[model samples]
Target: MIERLSIIGVGLIGGSLARALRAVGQVGEVVGCGRSGPNLEKAVELGVIDRFTHDPGEAVVGADVVFLAVPLGAMRGALSAIKDRLDASAVITDGGSVKGSVVADAVAAFGKVPTRLVPGHPIAGTECSGVEASFAELYRNRRVILTPLSETEPDALSLVSRMWEACGAEVTTMSVGHHDEVLAATSHLPHMLAFGLVDALARMRENDEIFRYAAGGFRDFTRIASSSPVMWRDICIANREALSAMLARFGIEMTDLAESIRRADGDHLLEIFERAKAARDRYVDRVK
Candidate 1:
């Protein structure tokens, strides 16, 4: 159990983690730090955290663990703030969407990667983004991927793994580069597509009619368009290299599909649809 846990950026991710740990009696005290005073107060009022602070340095004073839940662009600032204040024995982890950028941020802030720092990303969330959107069960049945550096401590990795397990997450580890590439294709690209689709539709001359006549399929595919733009913007920029590669590949496929449709190639359309259906079916079955 963590005697004291410090959560930076106590919005959805951090607040949910604090609530999860407290729910299981795994944390003695949770200190939340964020920019908003009211949000911090609401976290305390909701009992997601035991206390609150605006200073990242102060929040980690006696914490046994520190969870960085800020956006990728803000990670360096937050890490720098608490770098010298963290307890020597405190284990640090994160819920950053991009592992590679986060590791770079830590290295830049600390002048070296700390062995106790475990860079992680949880493959879970709703299209919601505030303290009110947090829940103790957010990580339940979800996967949390940790990208630990070669110099990372074994005990630190184990401790972070156990904490996620306690939150009902299945923990796994991977190389930072591989994790970034995988997420760029799976998570980042999807979000970008959703946002771009919704934006393009909204800007059309028949936007009102299009939106009014939109069906469930459109809503389902673009649901992630409603997620926090600020956070997604940071993630896209942080993983731009891998994301750009994925986007280019997807664009090529889109061009091929468009050409097939223009040529009225029934076999090409049928084959592509069949492949997609089978892939989606396998994915859904595995998820279930």
Candidate 2:
């Protein structure tokens, strides 16, 4: 069990982790660090953290484990703040979606990727934000991916693996490049498409009428568009190369679909639809 845990951003991800650890009685003291005083107070009131501070350095002074749960863009600043203050033996990990940028930030702050630093991403969360939206079950049965550098200590990786397991998440490891590419296709590109579709529809002349007649399909497909724009903007930029590749592939598929419709190729359209449906069905069965 972690004796002292420090979370550098007490929003959805960080607050949920704290809550999960508390529920499982795996962490001793949870200190939440954030720039927003009101949010920190709310986190304390909700029992998501034992205490909070605006200073990241102070929060990590005695922490046995530190979770940098801030946005992708804010990672460098958070890492810099706690760099000198982190205990020598402290295990440093993060919930940032993009591992390459996060590893770079850690190297910038610490002069190298410390053996104690392990880059991780928890594949969970709704279109929600802030302390109030967090819950203990957020990571339950969800996948947590770890992309540890070659310099990472085995003990550090094991500790982080166990920590996520204690939160009821299934942990897996992958290379940093592979993690970025997979997440770009599976997560980032979908969010981008959702946001772009919703935004395009909203700008149409008959937007009000269009939305008024919208159905469950539109609502479910665009649910992720409600996520924090700033966070997604940072993610898109951080993983731009991989996301661009995915977008190009998606554009090619869209062109093919459009051509099929123009040619009235019913068989081709049916083939595409059937393939997609079967892929989704297999995924659902695996999850079940």
* Runs in model 2 lying further than 4 Å from the true structure: none
The superposed Cα distance between candidate 1 and the true structure at residue 237, in angstroms, equals 0.7
What are the models' TM-scores? 0.99, 0.99
List residue ranges in candidate 1 displaced over 4 A: none
Q: What lDDT tens digits, residue by residue, belong to model 1 across residues 196-226? A: 9999999999999999999999989999999
Give lDDT tens digits, candidate 2, residues 1-288.
999999999999999999999999999999999999999999999999989899999999989999999999999999999999988999999999999999989889889888999999999998999999999999999999999889999999999999999999999999999999999999999999999999999999999999999999999999999999999999999999999999999999999999999999999999999999999999999999
Candidate 2 RMSD computed on C-alpha atoms after optimal superposition onto the true structure:
0.7
